[model samples]
Target: MFDMFKNNPISSIACVLPPALVNAFAKQNFYSPEQVRHVFTNELKTEHNIEYALAMFCSQLDFDALQLAVTYKELRANVAKECFGGWPRFNFDSLLDYSRQSAGAGGGFAGDGGCGDGACGGGGE
Candidate 1:
């Protein structure tokens, strides 16, 4: 999955987003697209946040925000299904907390020997 994401054209948007946000999404366990979308949209709601960052970056690169958003939505859905197995609802806040704790402990991201269940390595948690 990480390889697919890396090779995907839409994955370039990850460069515009904060590394922490990208890492959190990729490393953490999100049971459903709706759950991840809720957290993602909320994370972008702040001024000069994800949406603003994407818009500014995309504008300079002549990328389309609407199309990128659509593609990003698809990416999130795929991540939820492939990495999380579309399991039962999980707490988004808890996932964020776990991410923080893991990072603080020098665990890095999931693929880097973090506490995650190897989801980012292309297997479900």
Candidate 2:
């Protein structure tokens, strides 16, 4: 690939790629270098933040190539969720407001589900 990219437009593109993207271009257990490079180049072109996400996903890769989960897509999703689960992109205050609205509206159903006779339906426990 270095020989092929020496004087090519893709060389400039490859130079700016992150290391995670660079490593994905190499041959893996059953695939050839050209095959790996072509596939990952296309994915890198299409997917946002794919190099970082794939780095998170590839930490689980084994030199032994042990098969655990089935697909790269599933593994990628799981890794991405673990990495970005608390990104804080939503308006959680709306959920808090909703909970408060339910607090006094339904016979104490907002918590504990009391019988209202103060028995708690637990043999007076």
lDDT winner among the candidates?
1
List the global CA lDDT of all models.
Answer: 0.33, 0.30
Q: What is the C-alpha lDDT profile of model 2 across 58-118, one tens digit per residue? A: 4334311534335444543432232223221212222222223323331222222222331
Give model 1's TM-score versus the native structure: 0.27
* 95: Cα error in model 2, Å: 30
TM-score of each: 0.27, 0.19
* Model 1, position 84: C-alpha lDDT score: 31
Which pairs clash (backbone N, Cα, C closer than 3 Å) in model 2? none
TM-score of 2: 0.19
Model 1, 1-125: lDDT tens digits are 33422342222222212334445555432223333344445543432223323332222223342455444434344433332334223234433443444335523333222323322222222
Give residue 79's lDDT in candidate 2 (0 to 100): 26
Looking at model 1, residue 13 earns an lDDT score of 23
